[model samples]
Target: MTILQTMVSVMLAAILTDNYVLSKFMGICPFLGVSKKLSSSLGMGAAVIFVMACAAAVTYPVYQLLVAFDLAYLQTVAFILIIALFVQLVEIVMRKLLPPLYKALGVYLPLITTNCAVLGVTLNNIDDGYSFGLSVWNAVCVGMGFTLSLIIFAGVRSKLENADIPETFKGIPATLIAASIVSLSFSAFSGMI
Candidate 1:
């Protein structure tokens, strides 16, 4: 497929069917933590997408090169370091050029390093043995998945915030129930892959 087509597929896959937080369950904390508010969750989701795309774009080639050197076993550590450094670079750039976004996303940006979704996508790319284009595509898609889930979760939580949910089904309990449903709802997309 053309690069454009690949990009589109990746974007759709990430944002729609195979969502990271809902389907893969890679990022539950921020998905739940920042999701109490729609705007914050959106902010966090956007940040994750950016970081995921960047991580995949850079890590794919590095992973390929590392494999070439017969050092495939180092992928875990290498990916972690690469993602951490990239998040740092993004923090620096955001602080200098976009102070507002930095203020909004600064706290969460550091947290991205430990987010399993980001690392999961990196490792997933290697496991799938995707080409440079496809690896990056999947990574972006996975991030989109994360973003989509966060957006939906935020919306759900916002509406639920006003309701008088049962004692057992309040707060995180309700949130978890909602996520479970979302996960089940999105599982229909697995056939597409």
Candidate 2:
């Protein structure tokens, strides 16, 4: 396929079929925690996108260097270190420029350092043998997919607040049910691409 076609395919696959949060279930902590508020959800989503893309960019070369020196066994360790540093940088920048958002995200910001989705995308890029450009594109697309799931679920949670429901399933249980339904819907797209 041409470059454009490849990019389109990757975007579609990541955003619709292979979503990190919805489909792969990689980052459910913040997906459930920060998603209670739309603003916080968006902030978290943006932060994930920025971190994932940057992590992919930085880790790809780091992994390459590891391979060059026959230290491929350290790929996971190296990737985690890079991800942690990037998350710290994002925290510093966000804290300075968007204090309110920074405050809203609070602990979730630091939690992103250990978010599996971010690490998963980076490792997948390496495991899948994507070239540098494709790796970056895949990472960005995965981030966008994560952002989409967060915003969509945040909207659902907003409406659910007012919806009458059985007392037993009112809070997290209700949210989990909604997320499961959403996941099922996402599964329908598996054969589309």
Candidate 3:
């Protein structure tokens, strides 16, 4: 297939049937925590997107270099360092330019440094052996999927915030039930493409 065709397919799959957060179950912490509020979810999603994109760009070349030097086993360590540094850079920029968003994101901003979803996509790009352009596109798509899921969950939570629930399924239990329903809905997209 052509590069364009490949990228389009990757984007669709990543954002729909194979969403990192909902489908693959990576980065559930932020998915559940920041998703309590729409504003916080949006900010967290943007931060994750920036980190995922940069991590993909930087880690691909770094992994290639590691393989060249017969140090492939150290990729996990190298990727962690790369992702951590990139998250730090993003945190600094957000703090300066978007103070309110930075404040809202708060601990989640630093938490992205350890977010498995960021690391998962980076490693997934390398494992898939995608070209640089495809890797970047896949990363962006995964980030978008993450954002889409977060926003949808936040909307659900907002509505539930006002809804009356039985005592047994009040807080986290109710949220989990909602998340399960959402996840089941996403499965309908499995046959989409």
Candidate 4:
């Protein structure tokens, strides 16, 4: 495949078949927590996209440096520190410029620092042996996948608000069921690449 084909395939795989949230299930905490409202979900998704992309950009070279120093085992620790720094930067910027979104995200904004999906993208880039550009692209695509899942799930959850249901299936139970169905739907894309 050519470079363009490779990039497109990577983007499609990340945003569809191998979604971190819906398929790999890497970052479910914020996926479920902030998805209750469309507005909050969008805010959270944007923050995640920012952090994941920035983390990937920083971590790729940092990982190379670690490998050079024969400290590869410290990649996880180094990646986490880098991700945390970016998340903190995002938090500070959002808090100052977008107070409403900042308030909307609440504790979940901080949770981005610990989001495995962000870390996973950085680590997976190294594992997949992608060049710097591909790694960043993969991170952005993964973040888009995360956002897509959140938006779809948020829509599903919103519809559940007025749906009449058995008492046993209300609240969290209903949300889980809906999420499972949404996840199942994504399975159809498994071999599309």
Candidate 2 residue 24 C-alpha distance from true site, Å: 0.6
Candidate 2 colliding pairs, count:
0
Write down the TM-score of every candidate: 0.88, 0.91, 0.91, 0.91
What count of clashes does model 3 give? Answer: 0
TM-score of 2: 0.91
Q: Tens-digit lDDT track for model 4 on 82-190?
A: 8787778878888899889778665566888878898899989999999999998999999999999999999998898999989998888888888999999999999
Candidate 3 per-residue lDDT over residues 1-193, each given as its tens digit: 8877888889899999999988899999889888988888888888788778888999888988999999999998999988888888877888899889778665577879878999999998988998887888899999999999999999999999998999999999999999999999999999877
* lDDT (Cα, tens digit) per residue for candidate 2, span 35-62: 8888878878887887888889999889
| Collision pairs in model 4 | none
Candidate 1 C-alpha error for residue 22, in Å: 1.2
Segments in model 1 whose C-alpha atoms lie over 4 Å from true places: 1-11
Which candidate, 1 or 2, would have the higher lDDT against the true structure?
Answer: 2
Model 4: worst 10 consecutive residues (lDDT sum): 101-110
lDDT of each: 0.82, 0.88, 0.89, 0.89
| Tens-digit lDDT string for candidate 1 (1-193) | 8888767877777766667777667888888788887778877878888898889899988987998999989999999999989999999999999999899888889889889989998888878677887876787677667777788777877777788889877767887887888788788777674
Tell me, by TM-score, which candidate is best: 3
Report the error of model 4 at residue 25, Å: 0.3
